[model samples]
Target: MIEVKNTGKPDERRDFPRGHLDVLDLTGLNFGVATFDPGWRWSESLRELAGTDSCQTHHNGYVLQGHLRIRMDDGEEADVGPGDVFVVPPGHDAWVVGDEQVMVFDFAGGMAEYAKAKG
Candidate 1:
Protein backbone atom coordinates (compact mmCIF):
# COMPACT_ATOMS: atom_id res chain seq x y z
CA MET A 1 0.00 0.00 0.00
CA ILE A 2 1.06 3.58 -0.56
CA GLU A 3 0.13 6.73 1.31
CA VAL A 4 0.72 10.11 -0.21
CA LYS A 5 0.22 13.34 1.64
CA ASN A 6 1.56 16.86 1.93
CA THR A 7 2.22 19.31 4.70
CA GLY A 8 0.25 21.86 2.74
CA LYS A 9 -2.89 20.20 4.02
CA PRO A 10 -2.53 18.47 7.38
CA ASP A 11 -5.04 16.25 9.08
CA GLU A 12 -5.15 18.62 11.99
CA ARG A 13 -3.65 21.91 13.07
CA ARG A 14 -3.03 22.73 16.72
CA ASP A 15 -2.24 26.25 17.82
CA PHE A 16 -0.43 27.33 20.93
CA PRO A 17 1.14 30.52 22.14
CA ARG A 18 3.84 31.69 19.76
CA GLY A 19 3.55 28.62 17.59
CA HIS A 20 1.43 25.92 16.03
CA LEU A 21 1.56 22.34 14.83
CA ASP A 22 0.33 20.71 11.64
CA VAL A 23 -0.34 17.01 12.12
CA LEU A 24 -0.85 14.35 9.51
CA ASP A 25 -2.08 10.94 10.59
CA LEU A 26 -1.44 7.93 8.40
CA THR A 27 -2.25 4.26 8.72
CA GLY A 28 0.96 3.41 10.50
CA LEU A 29 2.53 6.76 11.23
CA ASN A 30 1.63 10.07 12.73
CA PHE A 31 3.62 12.96 11.31
CA GLY A 32 3.80 16.58 12.32
CA VAL A 33 5.32 19.86 11.31
CA ALA A 34 5.92 21.97 14.37
CA THR A 35 6.51 25.68 13.99
CA PHE A 36 7.79 27.49 17.01
CA ASP A 37 8.14 31.23 16.81
CA PRO A 38 10.82 33.31 18.42
CA GLY A 39 10.71 33.30 22.21
CA TRP A 40 8.54 30.23 22.24
CA ARG A 41 9.10 27.96 25.21
CA TRP A 42 7.42 24.67 25.84
CA SER A 43 6.98 25.27 29.55
CA GLU A 44 5.50 28.68 29.15
CA SER A 45 3.40 27.84 26.15
CA LEU A 46 1.95 24.45 26.89
CA ARG A 47 2.66 23.35 30.44
CA GLU A 48 -0.64 24.47 31.74
CA LEU A 49 -2.49 22.84 28.96
CA ALA A 50 -0.53 19.64 29.32
CA GLY A 51 -0.79 19.54 33.09
CA THR A 52 2.79 18.47 33.40
CA ASP A 53 5.81 20.09 34.96
CA SER A 54 7.90 19.28 31.93
CA CYS A 55 7.24 18.02 28.44
CA GLN A 56 6.03 14.47 28.59
CA THR A 57 5.93 13.80 24.87
CA HIS A 58 8.82 12.06 23.25
CA HIS A 59 10.21 13.73 20.13
CA ASN A 60 11.93 12.29 17.11
CA GLY A 61 12.43 14.95 14.51
CA TYR A 62 14.67 16.85 12.16
CA VAL A 63 15.31 20.52 12.16
CA LEU A 64 14.51 22.19 8.90
CA GLN A 65 14.92 25.86 9.87
CA GLY A 66 16.35 27.92 12.71
CA HIS A 67 17.61 26.54 16.00
CA LEU A 68 16.16 24.95 19.09
CA ARG A 69 17.42 24.04 22.55
CA ILE A 70 16.31 21.12 24.64
CA ARG A 71 17.01 20.59 28.31
CA MET A 72 16.19 17.32 29.89
CA ASP A 73 14.76 16.90 33.36
CA ASP A 74 18.12 15.64 34.56
CA GLY A 75 19.80 18.84 33.26
CA GLU A 76 21.21 17.35 30.08
CA GLU A 77 20.80 19.75 27.22
CA ALA A 78 21.59 20.23 23.58
CA ASP A 79 20.99 22.61 20.76
CA VAL A 80 19.82 21.59 17.31
CA GLY A 81 20.15 23.58 14.12
CA PRO A 82 19.23 23.10 10.52
CA GLY A 83 20.06 19.69 9.10
CA ASP A 84 20.11 18.10 12.51
CA VAL A 85 18.15 15.05 13.49
CA PHE A 86 17.26 14.57 17.14
CA VAL A 87 15.48 12.21 19.46
CA VAL A 88 14.34 13.66 22.72
CA PRO A 89 12.68 11.53 25.34
CA PRO A 90 9.85 12.60 27.52
CA GLY A 91 10.53 14.94 30.46
CA HIS A 92 12.28 17.85 28.83
CA ASP A 93 11.82 21.51 28.10
CA ALA A 94 12.43 23.13 24.77
CA TRP A 95 12.57 26.58 23.33
CA VAL A 96 13.49 28.43 20.19
CA VAL A 97 17.10 29.49 20.34
CA GLY A 98 17.02 32.82 18.56
CA ASP A 99 14.77 35.38 17.00
CA GLU A 100 14.01 33.07 14.14
CA GLN A 101 11.05 30.79 13.83
CA VAL A 102 11.95 27.14 14.32
CA MET A 103 10.54 24.62 11.90
CA VAL A 104 10.77 20.89 12.51
CA PHE A 105 9.35 17.72 11.02
CA ASP A 106 8.39 15.30 13.77
CA PHE A 107 8.11 11.61 12.96
CA ALA A 108 7.59 10.24 16.48
CA GLY A 109 4.11 11.55 17.02
CA GLY A 110 5.29 13.84 19.79
CA MET A 111 2.88 16.48 18.67
CA ALA A 112 0.02 14.00 18.59
CA GLU A 113 -1.32 15.40 21.83
CA TYR A 114 1.15 18.14 22.54
CA ALA A 115 -0.09 21.62 23.34
CA LYS A 116 -3.60 20.30 23.65
CA ALA A 117 -5.86 21.15 26.54
CA LYS A 118 -6.27 18.37 29.11
CA GLY A 119 -9.70 17.74 30.46
Candidate 2:
Protein backbone atom coordinates (compact mmCIF):
# COMPACT_ATOMS: atom_id res chain seq x y z
CA MET A 1 0.00 0.00 0.00
CA ILE A 2 1.01 3.58 -0.63
CA GLU A 3 0.02 6.80 1.08
CA VAL A 4 0.64 10.44 0.46
CA LYS A 5 0.02 13.41 2.72
CA ASN A 6 1.01 17.05 2.66
CA THR A 7 2.23 19.17 5.51
CA GLY A 8 0.38 22.06 3.98
CA LYS A 9 -2.80 20.36 5.08
CA PRO A 10 -1.99 18.63 8.31
CA ASP A 11 -4.56 16.35 9.93
CA GLU A 12 -4.02 18.17 13.20
CA ARG A 13 -2.07 21.08 14.62
CA ARG A 14 -0.87 21.73 18.15
CA ASP A 15 0.35 25.11 19.24
CA PHE A 16 2.56 25.86 22.23
CA PRO A 17 4.81 28.61 23.40
CA ARG A 18 7.57 29.30 20.88
CA GLY A 19 6.59 26.40 18.73
CA HIS A 20 3.89 24.48 16.89
CA LEU A 21 3.34 20.99 15.56
CA ASP A 22 1.58 19.97 12.38
CA VAL A 23 0.76 16.31 12.04
CA LEU A 24 -0.48 13.96 9.37
CA ASP A 25 -2.09 10.78 10.58
CA LEU A 26 -1.37 7.95 8.19
CA THR A 27 -2.37 4.31 8.33
CA GLY A 28 0.64 3.13 10.32
CA LEU A 29 2.24 6.36 11.30
CA ASN A 30 1.59 9.75 12.74
CA PHE A 31 4.09 11.98 10.99
CA GLY A 32 4.75 15.50 12.11
CA VAL A 33 6.53 18.67 11.24
CA ALA A 34 7.59 20.43 14.42
CA THR A 35 8.72 24.01 14.37
CA PHE A 36 10.38 25.57 17.38
CA ASP A 37 11.24 29.20 17.49
CA PRO A 38 14.27 30.78 19.10
CA GLY A 39 14.53 30.23 22.85
CA TRP A 40 11.97 27.48 22.85
CA ARG A 41 12.47 24.94 25.57
CA TRP A 42 10.41 21.87 26.39
CA SER A 43 10.52 22.49 30.12
CA GLU A 44 9.76 26.17 29.92
CA SER A 45 7.22 25.89 27.15
CA LEU A 46 5.39 22.59 27.07
CA ARG A 47 6.04 20.91 30.43
CA GLU A 48 3.07 22.49 32.18
CA LEU A 49 0.74 21.43 29.43
CA ALA A 50 2.19 17.94 29.41
CA GLY A 51 2.04 17.58 33.19
CA THR A 52 5.40 15.91 33.31
CA ASP A 53 8.83 16.67 34.70
CA SER A 54 10.21 16.00 31.27
CA CYS A 55 8.89 14.92 27.90
CA GLN A 56 7.68 11.37 27.86
CA THR A 57 7.21 11.08 24.11
CA HIS A 58 9.72 9.28 21.96
CA HIS A 59 10.88 10.84 18.73
CA ASN A 60 12.45 9.54 15.55
CA GLY A 61 13.21 12.70 13.72
CA TYR A 62 15.22 14.33 10.99
CA VAL A 63 16.45 17.80 11.49
CA LEU A 64 15.54 19.99 8.57
CA GLN A 65 16.58 23.41 9.83
CA GLY A 66 18.46 25.05 12.64
CA HIS A 67 19.53 23.22 15.77
CA LEU A 68 18.09 21.57 18.87
CA ARG A 69 19.57 20.29 22.09
CA ILE A 70 18.16 17.33 23.96
CA ARG A 71 19.18 16.44 27.49
CA MET A 72 17.99 13.21 28.95
CA ASP A 73 16.97 12.63 32.54
CA ASP A 74 20.12 10.62 33.10
CA GLY A 75 22.30 13.57 32.01
CA GLU A 76 23.00 12.27 28.51
CA GLU A 77 22.64 14.95 25.89
CA ALA A 78 23.20 15.78 22.27
CA ASP A 79 22.50 18.37 19.64
CA VAL A 80 20.71 17.83 16.36
CA GLY A 81 20.92 20.23 13.47
CA PRO A 82 20.39 20.42 9.76
CA GLY A 83 21.33 17.19 8.01
CA ASP A 84 21.02 15.19 11.21
CA VAL A 85 18.70 12.32 12.01
CA PHE A 86 18.03 11.50 15.63
CA VAL A 87 16.13 9.32 18.04
CA VAL A 88 15.14 10.73 21.39
CA PRO A 89 13.55 8.51 23.96
CA PRO A 90 11.05 9.52 26.60
CA GLY A 91 12.25 11.39 29.70
CA HIS A 92 14.08 14.32 28.19
CA ASP A 93 14.14 18.06 27.97
CA ALA A 94 14.81 19.87 24.69
CA TRP A 95 15.45 23.38 23.64
CA VAL A 96 16.32 25.35 20.56
CA VAL A 97 20.07 25.71 20.33
CA GLY A 98 20.43 29.24 19.16
CA ASP A 99 18.68 32.30 17.90
CA GLU A 100 17.56 30.43 14.83
CA GLN A 101 14.32 28.54 14.71
CA VAL A 102 14.33 24.76 14.44
CA MET A 103 12.33 22.53 12.13
CA VAL A 104 12.17 18.76 12.40
CA PHE A 105 10.38 15.98 10.58
CA ASP A 106 9.18 13.51 13.20
CA PHE A 107 8.51 10.03 11.87
CA ALA A 108 8.06 8.49 15.31
CA GLY A 109 4.95 8.54 17.47
CA GLY A 110 5.76 11.51 19.65
CA MET A 111 3.92 14.08 17.60
CA ALA A 112 0.73 12.15 17.98
CA GLU A 113 0.31 13.81 21.35
CA TYR A 114 2.95 16.53 21.43
CA ALA A 115 1.85 19.75 23.08
CA LYS A 116 -1.58 18.43 23.94
CA ALA A 117 -3.07 19.03 27.35
CA LYS A 118 -2.66 16.19 29.82
CA GLY A 119 -5.75 14.36 31.12
Clash counts for all predictions: 0, 0
User: Candidate 1, residues 13-93: lDDT per residue as tens digits?
Assistant: 999999999999988788999999999999999999899999999989999999999999999999999999999999999
Positional deviation of 108 in candidate 1, in angstroms? Answer: 0.5
Model 2 compared with the native: what TM-score?
0.96
lDDT of 2 at 30: 91
As a TM-score, model 1 comes out at: 0.96
**What are the Cα lDDT values of the candidates?**
0.92, 0.93
As a whole number from 0 to 100, the lDDT of residue 7 in candidate 1 is 99
Q: Which ten-residue region of model 2 has the weakest summed lDDT?
A: 110-119
* TM-score of each model, in listed order: 0.96, 0.96
Q: Compared with the true structure, what per-residue lDDT tens digits does model 2 show for residues 1-119?
A: 89998889999899999999999999989999999999999999998999999999999999999999999999999999999999988999999988998999999976778887767
**Candidate 1 Cα errors over 4 Å, as ranges:** none
Q: Which stretches of candidate 2 lie over 4 Å from their true place?
A: none
